[model samples]
Target: MTRFSGFRVLKEALTGHNGWAPLWRNPAPKPAYDFVIIGGGGHGLATAYTLAKTFGQANVAVLEKGWIGGGNVGRNTTIIRSNYLLPGNQPFYELSMKLWENLEQDTNFNSMVSQRGIINLIHSDAQRDAYRRRGNAMMLSGAGARLLDVDQLRQMVPFLNYDNARFPIRGALMQSRAGTARHDGVAWGYARGADSRGVDIIQNCEVTGFRVEGGKVQGVETTRGFIGAGKVGVAVAGHSSQVMAKAGLRLPIESHALQAFVSEGLKPTIPGVITFGAGHFYVSQSDKGGLVFGGDIDGYNSYAQRGNLPVVEDVAEGGMALMPMIGRARLLRSWGGIVDMSMDGSPIIDRTPIDGLYFNGGWNYGGFKATPAAGHVFAHLLATDTPHETATAFRFDRFNRGYVIDEKGVGATPNLH
Candidate 1:
């Protein structure tokens, strides 16, 4: 079947020499900067903005291969929740939630962050126990989370099928403030705001290599030219490994493809994001009334955005089970985005072995929600040269120390947290 992709339209929108807006009207002049950030995704752009905002470092430039937000920011399902199942991640994600709460007002950008709520459907007794512990842990950490039974799930979404489904809803762990945002709004807002602050947002400038001198990262060799910087940050998410290896650093992250699909605009069948614990299936209704959903990771190491058919089938089947009414609904869009799955499932926001180089990769799929907080925390690390207390556990050394923050306690799905 042919696909109806919002992503395809986006790729076309960012084309024609002058990528993204304002890139053509007035371009930036090439010069050495105080800080040069690679990858203009939500994380990278936000990091640069935070750096300048907090430290008054306006001599910063954000380099992008495509236009800003052309990467995962354009492709994410936009689920923002702190319903983490582990201690290491719950607190940090809670911090992210607070940041998300104030981001729109602060940035003067309509990120479209809706905190309506998110529900994780528990299909089995084991899933119930796991969610119970997760909900309790979240509350203890001062984040709101509640466990709802099958009856409660039905009450919340009356359309949900409680019986005769592949994964029956036994219960759910619900966080009232967990929700979504307009993915592109995040990147554009940050880009426009950062540019206004005298930060050079060099689009279509891909970093092909890194320049290191005396064991310190000096700058980046990009497609445009060699951009100099006192400190270089590799904020590249999906291409984190590829970008770092150019600087002779190896991160314990593997790239994988994650895809999301949207059904033709419906009557907003889903109030907020809903995830089935038994499978990696989740769905949410966009403001446009499209039923946006995604399944689990493609389950292999690959940079390919095209996914295997099994996942697509599984997601569709799960959607039908959740709301049988959508069984015949038209599938409007299908697209994939690559993710940098760190070993621990948590982000590695720390100073790598290389000096003057900061790494903010390995976000898994939490890039959208964590953008504001990622910026705040990463700036804290960059400006003060101290790992923010909240993001301390997400250090890069945790993998070697065996201190993995495996939130689902699943060694395999490091991206779940």
Candidate 2:
């Protein structure tokens, strides 16, 4: 594999850029492997890379139905943050935040991780109190947060509708290390690193069924063939239920389509990520000067990868409510990704009743932000039969044991979170 560096760039530039090699290999699946990962998205690829690099498990294969980055890994708004108020979530996400801080150098690829910071705008006194509590929680978790008063917030983002009588802006909970990254770059970096470490990345090879015998997973039946495996891990995002159903195990998750939008390119207006406290809207300016933003998911069970118009309207209303100037920007395009909404709004990274089968899903709206930690912890679970230290609370039996990590405190309702 070719190492990318400033010297390499200068050399390639001098040589007409013809010395560059492919990022990853498109090799055919082998007859069997020590481990098989069933998703090529960020979480799965990161898991594979960690298994190979950290755990020394190089005899691995990642099977994807479509090409890498075609799933939620690419179809996202690219926001990354660790602003949470829950005990189980705060530490894990903070770990992800730290990983994002060094991801580019660690992977030997530029992921465009810009820690420009993020703010959750408060609209009222009650909301201000709530955000203060959240900020305290974030600080306790070592994520580092601050409370910005109205004047400070106004100076930071002067274009917001601060005097709106309906949802008046009061303050904000800001995290200086939270920001965005190139979604595609993350997937490619992980894939390239995993492939460089001898992990076979089998694209267009979908897992059709689990090859189980006597309550143990033996391998997988894929579109290509029955690829034998000593252990199998699944990280499919929204299609978790359907995929796990093939193994006779039901998951406590529902699939919902979450839409994200990008507006036409213009002069950089939004400095960093800003979220509405009164509504679900959040916006950030991309390097291309396009306003990238999104809101709540389509409030219904769905396996489709596209969302309906009601959500589009709701997101637009949220952006307009937060910054009235957003109304002037025309929506350039929109896309959706199937989100696996777990019962408690927290993720699950645990082994199943079926032996040799491990599952990682139910990220809800926090998938992209949690990619690195989710992968590292999940790889820790797969490499060693124990949960990662920071991810001890994300277990499948949590709900039944009354230990649900509900960040929103919304009980077991998936959509409410």
Candidate 3:
């Protein structure tokens, strides 16, 4: 089970603001680009930036229907860690964490990247065994991680419930290198860097359909007009399936709501990212003294960002469990975003059946933290037309081949993992 980070309650006490806001400016289009990236979220922006930085400028475009950073880029709880339980995903995520190490220097965007330590709590013997295996895998991969028993857990999280009602702590998987970062800064930094490199950032341009030729995708047809591309790539998380269907393709992913909330501002109480594996809960505190967090998704498909009440109640209940002092904290606000639930918990980053087309999606809840890593690996794929060995298992046909990398072995609810 995941442990509650105990930061959400502190966010409610904040008076003046929600965390990140959107910045949208209408601009004219350039004649052409080397690559056209659809979806202006963190991954899309990062992809464009990486392409320009590596492949050189004058051929990249990021098209967004709404605005950059307004999608899941800003909507996620912003947890950045590589506590995955598999081989392919674990190393890939560790690489992403390495990029995040110098993102501020790379993009000159003060992302406020924090490495205040993150812990995954275990509630059952089964979970302890899983943590043991995962920890050993990390050690084998040369990543630093440890499995802490109940005694060590108490030292790490003194406020936690040692003896509990619903569940009790047995042990925890701790990765000292894991943490969170500012989401908007990450997007804006990449945007500014990519823009300086002459990449076009197009907002309010919705791709209505794809323009294909002899089984090759030539360009895209948008609400504004027809624009041609040498190749087309879709990185839209929430609307990935919708965009792919325009070309007669339907991914195994379904859009679902993942809601998050903040408490009124309190003193910087909660320190780092926390997850309650046994329950639907997680929390973290931002530098601004606001606790930022959410729990498991709503478990239903919906485009609406407004979530139901039960999730909020569940989150608050979990928060109170970890930090009883937060019982009186006022819930300031809550919002949700559409998550692209992949068939397996892992992401899908590979070539599809459509020629001259590609994908950088199936993120589920892994978007914000994996931004730089996604951009780098995806750019490598785009430029070389080859899968980064780390992402080879995340191909589209894995589902059909029965080569599923089900990290949590989450059966039907792909988003829950």
Strongest candidate by lDDT: 2
- For every model shown, what is its TM-score relative to the native structure? 0.91, 0.99, 0.91
Point out the higher-scoring one by TM-score: 2 or 3: 2
Candidate 1: C-alpha lDDT: 0.81
Note the clash tally of each candidate.
Answer: 0, 0, 18
Candidates arranged by lDDT, highest first:
2, 1, 3
Instruction: Give per-residue CA lDDT, model 2, range 1-417, as digits (tens).
Output: 788999999999999999988999999999999999999999999999999999999999999999988999999999999999888989999999999999999899999999999998887788889888989999999999999999999899999999888888888889999999999999999999999999999999999999899999999999999999999999999899988999998998999999999999989888899988467788999999999999999989887888999999999988887788877899999988999999999999999999999999999978999999988999999999899999999999998899998877888789888
Can you give the lDDT of residue 356 in candidate 2? 90
Using alpha carbons, what is the TM-score of model 2?
Answer: 0.99
Cα RMSD (Å) per model? 6.5, 0.9, 7.1
Candidate 2 residue 95 Cα shift, in angstroms, is 0.5
Indicate the worst ten consecutive residues by lDDT in candidate 2.
271-280
What value of lDDT does candidate 2 attain over all alpha carbons?
0.93
lDDT of 1 by residue, 296-325 (tens): 888787788768888899888777766788
Q: Which structure among the candidates has the greatest TM-score?
A: 2
